[model samples]
Target: MTDQTDGGRRLSTQEAARVLGVKPATVYAYVSRGQLTSRRDPAGRGSSFDAAEVADLARRSRREAAAPAGGELSVRTALTLIEPDRYYLRGVDAVALASRYRYEEVAEWLWTGKLAPGAVFTAPPEALAAAGRAVAALPEHSGPIDRLRVAVAAAAVADPLRFDLSEEAVLGSARCLIPTLVGALPEKAAPSWPGDGRISRRLWSRLTAREPDPDALAVLDLALSLLVDHDLAASTLAVRVAASARAHPYAAVSAGLGALEGPLHGAAGRLAHRMLREVLEQGSAAPVVAEYLRAGRRVPGLGHRLYRAEDPRATALFARLEELPHAAPALTAAREVATTMARQRDLHPNVDLALAVLTVSSDMPPESGETIFAISRTAGWIAHALEEYQAPPLRMRPTGHYEGPTPPQPLP
Candidate 1:
């Protein structure tokens, strides 16, 4: 039933659920997540939602459901599913999984479907040495992604079983290659431990020279677990395409890295970092945001395609950042940016903004978030590659729709 109120027409909980095409429990979940607003009925009947709001939410749901138009390639996998304001990995709540388990443990579960406590990925000495040499060969000015590309190539050459497509062989290679990639990065700080530690611990030294507090280190680890996989993202699709062509796991990861280089795919964190730094320097987000609009640039880190509300990853990371004393200023700046933009449009903060807060507060460089994303997402890429390996080879080819002048009149 709909009731007319001062704000507008309002729908009861059941009506809202029907409009959203979800169960009543899901509607309540949305309300709890701040994805939907609920008001108590004046008659004390039940909770009510704004009719316009429910209609808008229903439209977004429909658009998301029909995103893949005709002829669009869709691959089936038991990996990840992104919904209105939440995502799941292998049927587990990703945020809960990330918060409860270490990054390595979550990654192991994603790869093999079973949790192994205290899971550790150790790189083979030869592969590590090879990757280090290749990374060193790059020009000093090369970015982290460039160095990672070189490292993966060198590691692949060092593995004698690189061509093996067997699940066992691929899994073994993934475990070693991830650690090798992390180990190959040039360390910015002196070693706290003698070369053996979690991937997050080793990566910390490379990202910043500051000694990590337990809370900060925990946040980094949480970030890694949350980012391990995210459906078939653009880079993941690139990885799948390579795997479909029988590319080895290392080569498939390299393809993902190549795709990640695009500005739209992986560079948002750096841009967000710069924006937050400017907000800190200028003491307000209003002028900074105005300048961005004046220059005809879309504000970065404000929205996500997959999420209409707050990004679940951003929500999780922001909650953790709140507990860190050092992160206060950057976190405030992030919120200010979001609030300032919200006055004009109702965009929410995405993971890039949260990552920028972590990097900016931790004294890490702007590109550090991209590096973290690449490293963490390698597990996901490998997992997708594993799935692709089990399917028929060359199944990803799609017929091109050619639209041009008639072919017979090409006598130029």
Candidate 2:
């Protein structure tokens, strides 16, 4: 039962329990745990919950229940910590670090505790040549990620010292492998000169034909720095698992790249890019957002489970994008999408949305954001692999809970 109250519709305890897919006792427990709020009934009935609040709680409950059992394993790490609205890298504010340093400097800091102010990563001639040949052999219809996977594999094969898991050796491989991956991509822009060794500049040439303004390049570099690590994301976990099995750094990174190909992970930004483009062509976000909802598709890049407020990475990127004249239209469209969605639910823009604005305004293809994520996250994957190398081999193996029928009777 529900009552239309001055504040909103109020669901009785029974109704709340039914909505939450739990018993009445669990509903009371939720109120006590502060997961839900309840108010005393006016006519001396039992507690009542706000209808919208119960619905939101129910949604979260369904999502949590859908996740695989025993999937929430926790491991101690000194890398990154995600809070409600902000995240940190080794106890330092990530946004502040990105704002103050280049991507190479930040990556160096993440790898070693020491900061290298003018750090630069350069690909070796042999490894770069091998990766380039491998990437060039792929079909013309292959995507950026396909090229990246092939490049990493070829780079691994080219490195004679790839099996040396010592800290110094692994770091050496990382420094070379990162640049090799960037250098392997076929350049979309005309080669004007021997480029500065900055990873962002080289990656920019591969992403679009248009020359980048200084601010645009700065934003791209910042995006790279900000994305360096996010504390045991799915791909990072994959890297760790591979590393736990004593896989070499290159193989560990390959594991991460494989996991990143999933749509729910690295490909999110591409979806957001397409949606923003649609909003631009349609002249408003309403119709585009409405069509998405009508078709039972999520309006991507709006919410993140780790954040209740704005995603800090998104906030930082959006701030930088506002100063770029070319980004104004895409930025406005992003804001419109967020605002329109906000009217229904309090979802905020995530980093993917900000990345979409960058990709859309810069005349890059939809897959550019994923490529950036893959390249930037290589640093983090290598860091995790290095950490895992120090732990006991095969430490990530977990016992599975068996739920099969009686084995003896199934022999037929």
TM-score to native of every candidate shown: 0.83, 0.82
- lDDT of model number 2: 0.91
**Lowest-scoring 10 consecutive residues by lDDT in candidate 2?**
61-70
| Candidate 2 C-alpha error for residue 222, in Å | 0.5
What is the per-residue lDDT of model 2 for residues 1-412, given as tens digits with 9 covering 90 to 100?
A: 7899889999999888777755576688678879999998768987889999999987765554344356776665778999998998889999999999999999998898779988889899999999999999999999988999999999999999999988899999999999999999999977576556789988999999988877998999999999999998999999999998999999999999999999889889999999999999999999999999999999999999999988999999999999999999999999999999999898999999999999999999999999999999999999888877754456576667889885767555
Instruction: Tell me the TM-score of model 2.
Output: 0.82
Instruction: Score each candidate by Cα lDDT.
Output: 0.91, 0.91
lDDT of 1 by residue, 1-412 (tens): 8999899999999888877765577688678878799998777998999999989977765554345357477776889989988999899999999999988899888998899999899999999999999999889999999999999999999999999988889999999999999999999998666543789998999999999988999999999999999999999999999998999999999999999999999999999999999999999999999999999998988998889899999999999999999999999999999999999898999999999999999999999999999999999999999887755456677666789886888577
The regions of model 2 sitting more than 4 angstroms off are 1-71, 191-195
List the lowest-lDDT window of 10 residues for candidate 1.
60-69
